[model samples]
Target: MSQFSLSNDNDDSGRLKIHLNSCYLHVKVTRPYIIITMGDQIYQTSISEYPDGRWNEGFEFSVSYHAQLFDTIQLDVYDSYMILPDRHVGRAEIRLIQLQDMPATFTSFYEVWDKKLSTGASSHAVRKTTMATNVGALQATISYRFLHIGDPQQQQQQLQQHDLDRQPMEDDLIFRKHLQQNRDTADILFHKYEEGSHANMDQLHLGTQGHTESRTTSSSSANTMLGSLGSWFGKGTASTSLGHPTDPTTDDLPTDILNDIDSSLKTYPLLDTLGSWTVSKETNQILRAIGKLLAAFGQGFELSNLQMLSGFAVVERFYQELPREQRTWDVVRDLSEIQVASHLWRYSMASYGWKGLNFIGKGNGYLSDAIRHHSDSKSVMEHLSLPPDDLLAYEFRNSGAFRPSYFVAHDPSTHSIVLSIRGTMVRPKLIAYCNRHSIGALYIVGHSLGAATASLLTIMLLDYMDELQKGQSLPFTLQCFGYAPACCVSLDLAEKYKDHIQSIVFADDVVSKLCYGTMMDLKQMIIAGAEAAQNLGISQFLWTGAAGKEKWKSAFEQVAECRQRCIDSMENPRLYVAGKVYQFWLDPTPKNPTRIVVERTSPKRVSSELILKTSIIMDHLPTNFDIAFRRATESMMTEPREQQDGVLDQEDESRTAEQELKHTSKRGGTDGSPMIDEQYTR
Candidate 1:
């Protein structure tokens, strides 16, 4: 149970109001047709004549359930158009935990953005793409109150014995009136102390304390006193603490694991490329390299969905074809998308890593690619069941996937609607594989959707291992790399994994930021249909382009028109892409063609600009990362080096490092410009 006061200090209060009861959400929009929604619940106002700046007063809101579990709450404002689709004016997104710090009733200002369209005329055709820009401002005083139901049966018993209805009766109202009077008296006494001399401060405190005690004793109702008292006394105490945990005093590395990683490096010299990827700490280099390799498996699947059908055969072939220096990695198991409930989700079990010292100097084992392929026939979801109540607390359950138990910083957060059902089947298999292989350290890399799955797997895997070891320090370590991964966990979970996870983002990659803090709804189906219709045009254009024919030119035009319409209508859902992101931005001005700025720090605010200036799809391709890395390093592909186990001859690419640092430091620059020169060493 909680209360939120949404207000602006500069404006008049009491114009805007909001309330939540049980699972129901209620909203009141004042100027224009303001619609507010959470999940499937929505409340909208009719078209109004009030000009954009006419209102000064605000509103209030209240909810009855435990609102702390929500990761983000967004309020959208729209302007109704007579003939065209509604224009999205702006939005306000607030994390629930952030609101708990303010006074019970407080005012906050929210900025509004106007949709701007960028268009072009190509000789004979016009193209339009819409983007959002911060424009207007709205000031409103908003507040919410939640009624906590602690032990429903006990509450019912108390209510029945008191002969009281749920609503406030005359006696309850009288008691509340006295409580308020006493509170006001305390406030006056406290203020008097501030105005008076220091000699009277102690006297004022004693008087205020006595007044509060008297009020509490007089109004103590066994049935309702606890709730009111808790409210008055528990401000700020119930909220989750802000910010991340303190950094580890020492690196969580062991002697044996370091030796194993060193052995892998010695056997596979290409592993030395890891020194090029930098984090703040030197000990983290091994995990970063492992992440890059795991990311390759995810990128491998993107090569062709057909490869997924081949399963183990394709995995073996993929590894076998790699250069000798890169072939030391092995596929512990291959995961595949599977059916969960009624949806086919992507929770496959593929993890590629070094198999430790026993396999040193020996090639990784591979099953023949020519072996007959056998598809899994059993229903994967059939045996997947939820754990008992005791284990459920650690589990993460979303509209798409579920696990028995796992460590989580927060629950009931938004997950990508496209998340695969395969996650439900992969956890146990991953645990089993790790047990059998005697993995000293586990590292996973996932790109886009695979990144999301990897995140869930990391949490669940740790919890499973912890449970199995009975709180003892396990023999292995776990880390993950998310290359442009979607937001898979709640804000709390993201923060919890901050030290162990690295989410890499390329400049203006729409896929990484597309669904960060948003949810998909049935209403999106309409837009999905529109998007599908546009895809037909795109498909036709692709076919015609492939044939080197002018045929389907009209289809290409229609595709552009459809894209413009969707942008104008705001049909595309903007989901919040979460992670402790590290962005790589292309130099806005290619003055130094060799340099691509790197932002070592995470972004403070997510940019709402989703429109792509170049190829809309190419920004998300795995190859784009290669191009960025090339520009960043200003180096060509390195020739394959001869491999000799236990015979090391290498030098740090110190010259390349020196060249990268020659440019100006631009950390925290805007518009995807150079942020910083990457500088660190292993």
Candidate 2:
């Protein structure tokens, strides 16, 4: 057998350079992922030895020539590295090389081979075979000789920026010019230092035995210049620099690209008139803006389902268009009557928590199995797939144009079942189900307007405590809950119901704090002093059970450390003000805040100890953060529906025992006072 073999030549010594074509790559191609490797395959050559006086050309040739060879890194894993194009791998070329074994890092592969054999310009594809394939036939070493060539096209795709490789604009030119100038200045100074003109330069050039530089006035001037240059470079754009090797002139900007972006911005007018529209009407405009964004960003095939977002937006805008005389951001109105929609669910659908479970074989879980399993939630909305417990939608469903005959009622929202969405209705039905079953212990976890409703319900129940206590009977039910209670409610309203509700605050979820009049600065109340960290009571307040103990402790320490940094930065206390709010529901107290935080209370109808949503306010706690959210939101039922008999639906099983709620105009009573007397019973 002819002794066939691969070779690795590494002899890097004393400022040595090497020349090689782009084909000299160790490319590992798999179907999905392609890895390129640069190795010690280059024979001894110098960058300065280019045929013409093009030293810079030699550098460009080295990088670009190498880059172009990997025009296709199609992935298909096989024995060694085969050059099979259709070999189960994706289309794309990759060049792989080692960091250290490129040149002068290994000995000669061929003992007597000539140094410069067949050395002209040649670059198409590199032949790569594994070490195992090298064997006795081809003696090859599996050294860390690999070059990592990134896929610019793929990277552009990942960024979702279509015009990444497009011609540069004036902005790009400015940014790159700023970058290169700074570097050029740095090199010039380094050259001066080597000449030993500055303070102690000779020592730095030599090391411990040498001097650094002389502190001359000129040196100070040079140093100041460099400092300013550095600042300028940093202020300039770096991430936006997608400059090509062949630098384009300032006039190279594409006219069409600018025109496209200009067209898009025209949609959202920066200066719009504030007119006599009601608050709901104003909200509708904002919802419409968001809908436009969804339509713009999510246009591809995979995200075609996001078109539902458009419908969602329209629905929300329609809801906001509701007259303020009817109900301003009222959850009860939406749930009790399908016609009063301000589809605040627009925000709720996009990112409100745990809504994707509605498609699991027609169940009331979370998301539809389609979405939970599919990448972008299923092609259909999981929530829309689910039937809500609310009965109010029944009337709307009976309407000519807005009927929901598509979804079946394997599960129905009957008034008899007091907790959760017992039925499968469309949007109105779902809301009615939630409202109907949510009479006493209605944990209303919602966002945006939905969150506002949750807040209102929380306030109503707390304000009507006597009514609620009697209706729930402790052995019976609890009232509704909110996620990020809406903006319209005042801080006074939030505080009044603060004792009865539980809130999970996102450190970054500024929605509630921004919307509501005030935020409970628990950062100060709980994380101000270092001494507040070590208190076991605080630990127990946030975490208990064997599993949560260590994490709770660690998170406490992290929070403590972060707080110290904030405290140290006294002048700019907001340095750590970026910490997000988790959730702090109304403290169920009279006993103690800790009792509510720890979820010490047992379920009224069940023997299980309830899980109260509390988190260790720490540096990075995403998993625990999510768990705490669910804990605070567990056992949440949907709104109830009106009974078919036309009497009206009851929220809790014991709801009838409580007083009847007044119409929206007089919900709080004849004086428009807000009360939850309806949820409570005598």
Candidate that scores best on TM-score: 1
Error of 2 at 323 (Å): 47
State the weakest 10-residue window (summed lDDT) of model 1: 369-378
Best by lDDT: 1
TM-score of 1: 0.30
- C-alpha TM-scores of all predictions: 0.30, 0.22
Predict model 2's lDDT versus the native: 0.26
Q: What tens digits encode model 1's per-residue C-alpha lDDT throughout 49-152?
A: 55443423322332212232232344556766777777666554454445544554555665543322111101012212332344444554445332224545
Per-residue alpha-carbon lDDT of candidate 2 for residues 216-280, written as tens digits (9 for 90 to 100): 47645455344323322332222113222222332233334344333323233433333113222
**Candidate 2: where is the Cα deviation over 4 Å?**
1-284, 287-355, 358-442, 460-478, 484-491, 515-626, 629-682
